[model samples]
Target: MSLIQLYDTTLRDGTQAEDISFLVADKIRVAEKLDELGIHYIEGGWPGSNPKDISFFREIKKVRLTQAKVAAFGSTRRAKTTPDKDNNIRTLIQAEPDTVTIFGKTWDFHVREALRISLEENLELINDSLAYLKNHVGEVVYDAEHFFDGYKANPDYALQTLKAAEAAGVDCIVLCDTNGGTLPHEIPAIMEKVRATVATPLGIHAHNDSECAVANSLMAVACGAVHVQGTINGFGERCGNANLCSIIPALKLKFGHECISDEQLKTLRILSRTIYEMANLIPNKHQPYVGNSAFAHKGGVHVSAIQRHPETYEHIRPELVGNVTRVLVSDLSGRSNILAKAEQFNINLDSKDPLTQEILENIKDLENRGFQFEGAEASFELLMRRALGTLRHYFSVIGFRVIDSKRHEEEKPSSEATVQVKVGGRIEHTAAEGNGPVNALDHALRKALESFYPQLRDVRLFDYKVRVLPAGKGTASMTRVLIESGDKTSRWGTVGVSDNIIDASYQALVDALLYKLVKDQEQAG
Candidate 1:
């Protein structure tokens, strides 16, 4: 089996994503993580692109990467410029990386349309770019920009472009799905053609426009490619690039490739999530390796079989991918699921107590009311703890009210909330205002709790989401709320349900804070 080298551009191509920007310090932080995760190469950023990128390269040296080479990314030289004189080449030199990758137009259409240059000039562009990077760095990689589409249009010209890169002595030639239009089946033949033409090591760079970037990249590797370039969580232009999360595990477990260490594999899930959260984006639910729903079983028959034998329904064990197997509690959850989940919560359903029936009935009722327990583990924890006599309350709200007015003829309504609560068996009075009454209530509650438990300082609301119950039909409009909070490495999620949005938010927030307090106590003990 050919050893596949993973090249990560999460800091480079990843930043091109809409509304995605990384601080120079943030890029360095992720770079350090990738290095520790044992990725072969980390593409910092395009030094010539902007000030932040330049600063990233300047600051990146301060970080130490164990098993990765920092590769600087940029395009090839201009239509008519020497390697030393080209501004792009100087940017690559200034980056001072051990490796530099420059992409040039391989498609005839892009040369004539985008660059307004002749075919011969475009060929020179590819050759000159690789030579320029080679002169400065020990390893130089050239990307056949739009190689797949170029091959489909003019196979001979595309092959010639790769040949030019090979003749220039590039360390690797990467085939790019620039427009991300290539399919998995089409990659095998294209790779075969490119392999037949070029002698240098080949790489695959893919994008997720067709939602097959990872599949296409794997196919390319199956054919002959040795280097795979991607971004964490598939962050890139358009639909994004091939996701490294799926690529790494696929190569390591299924393909006999040893790119990253087992320890790195453990960190892969957290790293993927960290990148997503920093990007201010939600992790894709269906993302193969580290997705929340990747290992979740929702079917009743599958759940039953899983209880009898875990391998009955799972392909890859969830733990191998730094994810946990989740028995999704929905209408699909059966008696087996109830037992398994109850056991996980340390609740003895066999106690033959009325509380067992009560708990199960409450689960059905709350789920019917739109409270999803899959992510609301805090709610489930509270339920089980309450049943087991292990749960403790940080504070209990006495009464809360929302004051609104319709005094103005054409003005948006204002919301102010007042809440009375008991903390540590003592009354604490506080009032806070927020954009919404719920926010005000949350602020007030936290302010009151802070007096008693100052360590709650690390706990802050990370996310707030609401969903209307699908099964609601009566006058009581059941709404479900999920609140996610975090403190350093610990994340707590809680759920609540009510017709009133403020009430739902308050409930979820309180549970979330209380759960954090409980977990902190557990860790301390």
Candidate 2:
């Protein structure tokens, strides 16, 4: 099997995806990850496009990558302009990278329609640009812009353009599915014909418009391509580009091809999660290789079989990608599911015990009442403690009251809240004013308890969201609230549902504090 090179254009093409912008610091962080992941090439960004990318290219030069070469991206030199004087060309050259990827127009229509250059002149442009870069840079990659669609429309012209790059001694001729509308079966035949003619190393650059970028890239490899290029998390123009997360493992395990180190295969999950967190974007749970829920089991049959032998249900071992398998508990959960979940919850459960049935019944009732403990492990932990009588109360809620009033236009809207609590044998009274009655109430409660727990300084109200249950309809029924908070390392989340929104919020708030308190206690002791 041939060794394939993995090129990541996440910082450049990935950022071009709708509404994605990364800072210079994060771009550097992402580059570090790509290097750590053992990618062969990291296309940092276009230097002239934005200040952030320009700064990133400059700073990244100072950093060292163990296995990857940094590549700068830009278009070919402008028409009737010298490559040295053209700002786009100059930016790529000054970025001073190991490999420079310049995209040249391959589609005759794009040349005629977009560039308004004659077909023969367009071929000259491709030749002159590649030749110029070959002299100045260590390696030159020619992305034949819109190569796939152009091949379908005007095969002779597209081949002529790629031939131009090959004649110019470019390192690789990258075929771009710029429109992302190409199908899988269309790959091999097209690639086979082109590979027979072009002696240049072939690379595949696909988009996700049809959601087949990974599959198509794989197909191209089978047809004789050596390099695969894409952004992380399938991010790019339109729908996005092929996701390197899928492409990497697909090449390694599926095809017996190798691109990254065996160690990178271990840390893949951590790298994927880090990128998503820094981007502040939710990862696709079903994303093939590194998704969190990739190996999760919910059905009774799958759970039973996986319990017998993980390979019965798992395609790859969870630890192979630095992730662990998850067993979800829900309405479909049987005794095995419950037992497995209990084990994960650290709650002892004898499978044959009557308590198992009781816990299941309680879970069903809670689910019906709009309580989602699947994501709220803190709430579920409290349930297990209450059921087992193992939970110890950390604080006391003695008495609380709130007063809301609105003065004239000159005065600000305000509400006052007070809490009276007895901690250990001493009584503490605290009061505070806030923007809303609930806010005032929360402040007062925390103030009253802070003396007993000085660690509350690190704990905080990070985020709060409320959802009215479907049972409410138009009447006064119940509301569900999810509260998330964190300290330094890990974040803990909890939920509460009640007819009163304030009560729901309070319940969730209480769970957050109690969980943190318990964690602190565990660490201290």
Candidate 3:
């Protein structure tokens, strides 16, 4: 088989997903990332549809890509219109991309209903648009929209659409599962028939509404399609397009195909994360290969086995995808779990040491009381260091007081906190006001400490999460507070649990400060 081509449409179809919007600058940055990932073709948005896409096409020329060819995406000429006269075709040519892709109605149902044109006219539109675009661009791709459903609805007409594209001298004919409802089982027969009908090289463009986009894409390749079109992290309309994050690795590692170099493959996780950050979407942690939890081990047995031989639990080495193995601490943790964490933290401990068992029991007991450590590994590390008597005494909080009051119904509630602490026998006391009780407490605590540990000035709270544990206790329920703090270098999570929300927050806050102090001390050493 020839080398498979990777075509990314994140800037085009990915923006169609709900709650996703990318500026012209963002689209350019993403195109650069896709180029870095070694994708063969990038479909910039439809130049004819919107001004932003036109702006993107204008701006992207400033970037220098090494391998990828940027392609402008658009639809075929309108019914009763000539390719030269149609504005969509003219705009695509004006973009002057290295390649142009135009989707044409393939389903006879769509030709009759959506386009409201006769079957022959739709073919003419497909052939005329590609032939015209081909004269201007080095490569032209024809996307047969709803090709699978069209083939199933009317096999002969779907075959004719590919033939029309072939006659137009298209570089590739892409079969699109536009509705995303096609099952994987239905791909092999359809691809076999299509291959027999058209001499044009075939590509597969799948959607995930049936949760089979990735599977269907792989199946299409197995059935002899050489070009694959998808979006990063599967971002697209409806259930999203087939995820190149999954497809790329499967092709390279599983099928023994080289869609990208091994060095480029190592950057897959970073690419996935960068796109997520650009879209302002929280990454799906359970996403295969690139997600945070993809290689996370929490169960005691699983952790034990992976510690011996990672392949016992993981299908592939995490580092191959630029991810690391994470051991989560919970009630299910065993001695192996503690030891594994100790190794991860670079702390040496004998397997039979009593400290290991002691830490294991303490973690289990704390988890039983609703103190979660999985998301709060910083707090867990502090717990272990304190147990081993290696942690330094940064400062100790003596006591704290909080007051919240609202003067009138229309007035917002105001909170003030008073904090007292002792740093190496020097007593410091301070009070501060804030928008809420937790904010007031954090402000008061920092004010009381910054003068003693000046480096504390760099510390800031990044995220705060509060979960009510064991529901049905109403206001009396135990609350777990997880505080994420960061400075110039890095971020860490600390957790606290108590019936009092403020107290829980204070516990997390104190641990956060102590962890920062320890990190600073280690770096100085």
Top of the candidates by lDDT: 3
Q: Tell me each candidate's TM-score.
A: 0.91, 0.94, 0.97
Give every collision pair in model 2. none
Ranking by lDDT: 3, 2, 1
Point out the worst 10-residue segment of candidate 3 by lDDT.
1-10
Off by over 4 Å in 2: 402-416, 433-441, 460-463, 475-477
Can you write out model 2's per-residue Cα lDDT over 407-507, one digit (the tens) per residue? Answer: 88888778999889787788899999888987898788788888889887688776678888876366587898898788886777789999988778778
The sequence of per-residue lDDT tens digits that candidate 1 reaches over residues 1-525 is 667899999999988899899888788888888887888999988888888888988887877667799988888888877778888789889889878988988898898999999998888878877876776689998888999999999999988898888988999999999899888989877888777888899999999999999999999889988999999999899999999999999998898887887777888888888888778888787778798888788666788798788889877777886898787766556666666677875556763567766666777877766778888877788877886687877678888776765579898666667778797669977777777677777777777778888888888788888877755555466788998888987776898888877788888988888888888888798
Model number with the top TM-score: 3
lDDT (Cα, tens digit) per residue for candidate 3, span 179-286: 998999999999989988888899999999999999999999999989999999999998899999999999998898879999999999999999998999878989
Clashes of 3: 0
Better of 1 and 3 by TM-score: 3
RMSD of each: 2.8, 2.2, 1.4
Question: Model 3 off-target regions past 4 Å?
Answer: none
What TM-score would candidate 1 get against the native?
0.91
What ranges in model 1 sit over 4 Å off?
A: 351-357, 388-396, 405-415, 422-430, 447-458, 470-476, 520-525
Better of 1 and 3 by lDDT: 3
